[model samples]
Target: MSRRRRAEKRQTAPDPVYQSCLLAKFVNKIMYDGKKSVAQRIVYDALEKFAKRVKAEDPLAAFEQALENAKPALEVKSRRIGGATYQVPIEIPANRRISMAMGWIIQHSRAKAGRAMDERLAAELSDCFNNQGTTIKKKDDTHRMAEANKAFAHYKW
Candidate 1:
């Protein structure tokens, strides 16, 4: 940890189409090795495909819904005591919650057996929006773990 005061949080600009800062941040996280354009293309393409398949509203809405469904409320953290490691259930921060949701969704999508990125991402997003995908399953597992270890809640500072 730094002894000096932490730097201020920088403001982020929204995405070009939806004008959502959250989406922009998600895109930044999705980017690999500074390939931001590729990330943007993949997300936009996935949204476009979803919009065509769903055919009623905007793709951004679906994306937002997916994010909402994927976000986890609580997670268990490992804390060390004198000899044993305890599972401490902690409430996830808002920003981290969103990041984790996105990461899990993207990871599951990448691991799926799909022919194209758009198809895989769209499938994952749809599953997430419907609360029936790997991401949501992962969230459920986390919550279950946290619930199972609720006795360690007092260990949190």
Candidate 2:
């Protein structure tokens, strides 16, 4: 029997304004109700605000730094060994790391009250850029959990 190959990843075009694929991915993640334009506007406005807040000459660069700071190096995965389940420490791939970081930023921003999405995203990005936000805490927690489960590293198949 032939084995099925993994599906190809759909390619995303860069954002019109900044021409950055990373920003476009972020916009797509923020999109609601199939509103791509609205998501783009919110993200662009937040990046502008982030630029001012971080005093960055290039907001995209600063945003990349924030994203880098939020990416977790390790995470624990459940593995069934014998009759017991073990939490195996595993390294995250680059794409998954980026996806997870973006999700955390959006989640924390959406959790905030009394602010527009752009405002909240801007604040959250600034916090992430400065390495002091819920997103960063989440990443840290993931790392800590993986570290605590390093004894199960051999269980990873």
TM-scores of the models, in the order given: 0.91, 0.97
C-alpha lDDT of all candidate models, in order: 0.87, 0.95
Deviation from truth (RMSD, Å), model 1: 1.9
Worst 10 residues of 2 by lDDT: 1-10
Candidate 2 per-residue lDDT over residues 1-157, each given as its tens digit: 7598889999999999989999999999999999999999999999999999999999999999999999988999999888999999999999999999999999999999999999999999999999998999999999999999998898888
Displacement of residue 155 (Cα, Å) in model 2 is 0.8
| Candidate 2 Cα deviation (angstroms), residue 140 | 0.3
Cα deviation of 51, candidate 2, in Å: 0.6
lDDT of 1 by residue, 1-157 (tens): 8799988989889988789998898788778899988989988888888777666287887788779999999999999998999999999999899989989988998898847877898888888877897899999999999999999999997
RMSD of 2: 1.0
